[model samples]
Target chain A: MKFLTPAQVTALMQDAVDAQGVDLGQIRAQLVLSPSERVDWLIAAVENLRAFRQKL
Target chain B: MTFDPRVICRILAEEGTEFVVIGGFAAAVRGSTVLTFDIDVVPDRERSNLEKLARALRRLNAQLRTGSEVLPLSINADFLDQMQVSLTLTTDFGDLDLVFQPAGPKASYADWADGADHVDLGNRLIVAIAALDDIIASKRAANRVKDQAALPALEALSEQIKSQT
Candidate 1:
């Protein structure tokens, strides 16, 4: 597993919220999960979803 | 009155309480940590085991406080399979806190029972112990409250693992 420094985690959260099209509230909630859990959460929530549709 | 916390586990073992010594006490025995205190035992138990713990508390007049309710002689067993029982009861003399953990998550007594090493507690008795990695990982997993406690041990274990290479 990739270990994200505190700063990196913070940046990722900021970018997710700053995205003009998405809701900041939901992005922040995913970050509420512990730092260790966020990667898995994002992988399952975003990456996998993106992949699922790309494959189709 | 015994300085050794295992005294309580030994007593419980004799009393037919299905329990195992865990937490820092277990770590100390395994030489992972220098910490010592009253015994923390995870009992082989089911739901409502607190009633039995209450009876033991009555003997020591332990002070139990949860939310607004206060019951003397309290204990913490977060999990049935990995419960922690304090052989030391709360009283003026001093108190021993027994914390419990249920099965799974490497915090369970069942996990310890299966994977925990056996150490002699004298009198030809042996008790189950949690894995050093499991101990460090679980404590760290708790982050804030336990993360600090886990740091030194984790560092030590990391050194030991590296040295073994």
Candidate 2:
């Protein structure tokens, strides 16, 4: 495998950090949901997580 | 068991137990894209309300959640009154946290309810949701590693809400 230069490695790390940072787009998408829909979304998400954890 | 907050909130409302939803779940209600596995609520400290909450808890079959094992919970008005900080419990609907005083300036249930946003969750089930600002303040005051991690997203969501309104 070709080794990346130090500067390239640093840039890649920064890009990874940026990817993990807060996504305003996702937040805005959630905001489009009504209060009740938001709650529904939360419940569904939690349920899915629980199922995934159980399988693990 | 599934983490069904609607069933949990419905039980509380049906029992006429007054409370304000808080913590990560409240953040999500306020449009934060955070995934909370449990429901956190600050219940009214009145004796009658505590009694109502006790009834609701019993209906949910709530038991104290412990690291080693789940302990049986004896929920009563006096028992709830003596709980100075918080209690974590597991119910059929999933995990539930009863927060007597959240870590923030507005510590009491009434204080949170005063500025809470009333959300109608359909089915004639309207519940009080702690304001996004209060949620952010409490998370800041909490300052836990997890809380700190969640703050950036929560703050961004709060700013977004403010910009709109």
Q: For every candidate, what share of the true interface contacts is present?
A: 0.00, 0.86
Q: Give the clash count for model 1.
A: 20
Query: What are the lDDT figures for the candidates, one per model?
Result: 0.50, 0.89
Scored by lDDT, the top model is 2
User: Model 1 misses residue A14 by how many Å?
Assistant: 26
lDDT of 1 at B80: 27
lDDT of 1 by residue, B18-137 (tens): 555555555555443333434456655555455454444444445643446545533444322243432334433223455565323765547666767665656655556666666666
lDDT of 1 by residue, A1-56 (tens): 98999999999876654353333344345334432243234324444555677899
Weakest lDDT window of 10 consecutive positions for candidate 1 chain B: B79-88
TM-score of chain A of 2: 0.62
In model 2, the fraction of reference contacts reproduced equals 0.86
DockQ (C-alpha based) per candidate is: 0.01, 0.60
- Choose the strongest candidate by TM-score: 2
Tens digits of per-residue lDDT, candidate 2, B77-135, equal 88988999999999999899999989989999889999998888767678999998899
Per-candidate TM equals 0.52, 0.89
